[model samples]
Target: MNALSVIDDLKRRFPNEPEYIQAVEEVLTSIEDVYNENPEFERYNLIERLCIPDRIFAFRVSWVDDKGKVHNNMGYRVQHNNAIGPYKGGIRFHSSVNLSILKFLAFEQTFKNSLTTLAMGGAKGGSDFSPRGKSDMEVMRFCQAFIQELWRQIGPDTDVPAGDIGVGGREVGYMFGEYKKMAREFTGTFTGKGYEFGGSLIRPEATGYGNVYFLLEMLKTRGLSIEGKRVAISGSGNVATYTAEKLLSLGAKVVSMSDSDGSIYVPDGLSQEQLDYIFKLKNIYRGRIREFAEEYECQYFEGERPWQHVACDIAMPSATQNEIDGDDARALIANGCIAVSEGANMPSTPDAIREFQKARILYAPGKAANAGGVSVSGLEMAQNSQKLSWSAEEVDRKLQDIMTEIHKQCVKYGTEEDGYINYVRGANVAGFMKVARAMMAQGVL
Candidate 1:
């Protein structure tokens, strides 16, 4: 199939859905050569099928606030593909949730799951309801209302949902409890559950830790080490903090962390004590990153990201999608940043990626780098199925191995003539080949 033509047709059909279009264009363009090399894929129209979701579930979620007032929100579930295995992805709860965003996420999830070498498909669901400033009871009621409509469509062996940006362990627990009450059976319909339930060990730290592991592998190719390197990280959530914790344990200096409000830069590098304070500030108190700047007397930038301003040996964008643009990438390269390993999906824009590739710097896309979260979610599914839970060490070891294998796949497919590894091309081609072959073998289903 002609990649540009398909993208044009998609844009025409899906007007105003820039996120989904961008995701589809990126993958299709990256895999165009290999996709054309396979005649069966074109004959079977696999590209068309792969780009469109298998099904979409949209419903209304109505709940009562603490004031006993009623509110209604739109919820959605986009099951993109399940040719390989069951549908697996996160359930985000934010005001930004929409068909376009969820579709983009589901499309990305398909390849991300494939890279994990797991028998899982791509899916994403969420609501337009924001969890910020909501009380516990309000959140619980909203989750229950969401599951009331969703329980009939999902099962452990069908579609399993985890937590995303606004949905955390608390939200997962609330939704799982509602599902259990409705289905009358305790199964692994959800991951990232509380440890007291069927949750797996180190699930929270898996993504961040796995990102570092992948970065270390990339550094190994250039005869470099993370030790003594100054690192700039974005986001103060689970992914960013755990990434910082792991880096510190490995002798790296973490120089920055951020939130929705702004970023905090500690030029001297953050200490364990400072990180602990950040943990309390963000996790416990649910405060902003500026609090850390105030408490530690560091530099704080309001309404800005931590990329162009921070001078570091490494950059990790763990916040959100399209955070690092071309200018930020150019600045990072100009400031001598050597590597970037994404902890959030699609955090780097297309121009930024081009900048990284032009500079020949070690760069990893979110699908390959930030896949540890879903890799561990896959593990959680296995544990729940077998009624067994692995120890923290066992789970951590498996995560490391998965990240290593993903890096190997990227290198295998992404290496250039001059020896610079194009991880974006590598990840897209590798992931697309697997799903394309599977779709072809399944015979137009």
Candidate 2:
């Protein structure tokens, strides 16, 4: 029942896996007060059981490249917990994909899914394969090779894998096609599919649109609104772009967007035409953010994030984990930033989060704020099960409802004596209580 002691044991057991350990420590620390109050949880040893994954699958993926050269990559799927429902999560393809990262992701997914009120468990799968410069054919071949080892372990009613960072619509199509051939059934075994198939509407835009929805709710708590708020968002992927699109539509100004190379800061804010161009540049052309600067003659900071340099009312770190460190957090606070809604998993480091808490700024964690993507994925499963697809409006309405409910849950658990909401503590405790009760009821399976 001692959270630090449990963390010490985990650290000794998982010495080199900092990501996983960090994830566990964060949740355990946040929920320790409630966890200690429940003698049933301690008697059942739920913390130890919940920290470890139910199972992990690792395989070697061998695929041929464009020039007839063979490549080998390590593939992994960590099924963390399925006490609530079937295993569900995304399949990432990046050079940084590893057991530690996937485990951390899966652990977070457990609570994220619980917050959705959906029937899904936590799981994550990926390979250390980079698709940046690979040809379409080469990527297709790699997808097939990766699925050859994964197909048997996944299904629509079991573990449904969707797309992540390096895996997109194209990769999902390639892998789903291969899964169809291998399984000989055209079920919704995968999500984020093209509309030509059984894909749900608004699935692609769910995460970004949902992030803005949560941000608006947070702003409401302060008697403010998204209208005319200047925003700085990191990452040029789907989450960032569509978040900008949503923010622009709501009359908010999006001042910055970035990729791995650098950031483009448009002091005048980006127009719809410019955002369209960016869509073509990154999505269609696979180019960089620097191209935006070249085309629009804006300020481009080479090899720098958009955080420290941009002053805005809101900051959205849609990039990878640990992107915003203590320095970035300090700069954001000093520059008059008011709120941050994470669109990526664990994007803020511990120091950055502390700075935000100390400043008493409105901050939402990734698990609660970014649950829209998976929430819609759960909708996709429902539609597939019933053989029906909802319209875009229906899906959007459902996503907004889910994000609103998640915000309510955070407020329910996270409110303090001074009336300032500690959303991280709230989200962690709210999510953990649900899964913990479920685990206890399931009788330690």
lDDT of 2 by residue, 19-84 (tens): 898888888889998998999888988999999999999999999998999999999999999988
lDDT of 1 by residue, 1-445 (tens): 8999999999999899999999999999989999889888888888999999999999999999999999999999999999899999999998888999999999999999999999999999999999899988999999999999999989998999999999889999999999999999999999999888999999999899999999999999999989999999999999999999999999999999999999999887899999999888877788899888888788999999999789999999998889999999999999989999999989999999999988889999999999999999999999999999999999999999999999999999999999999999999998988988888777867
Provide TM-scores for the models: 0.99, 0.99
Q: What stretches of model 2 exceed 4 Å from their correct place?
A: none
Q: Per-residue error at 54 for model 1, in Å?
A: 0.6
Whole-model Cα lDDT of every candidate shown, in order: 0.94, 0.94
The TM-score between candidate 2 and the true structure equals 0.99
Q: Which ten residues in a row have the lowest lDDT in candidate 1?
A: 436-445
Clashing pairs in 2: none
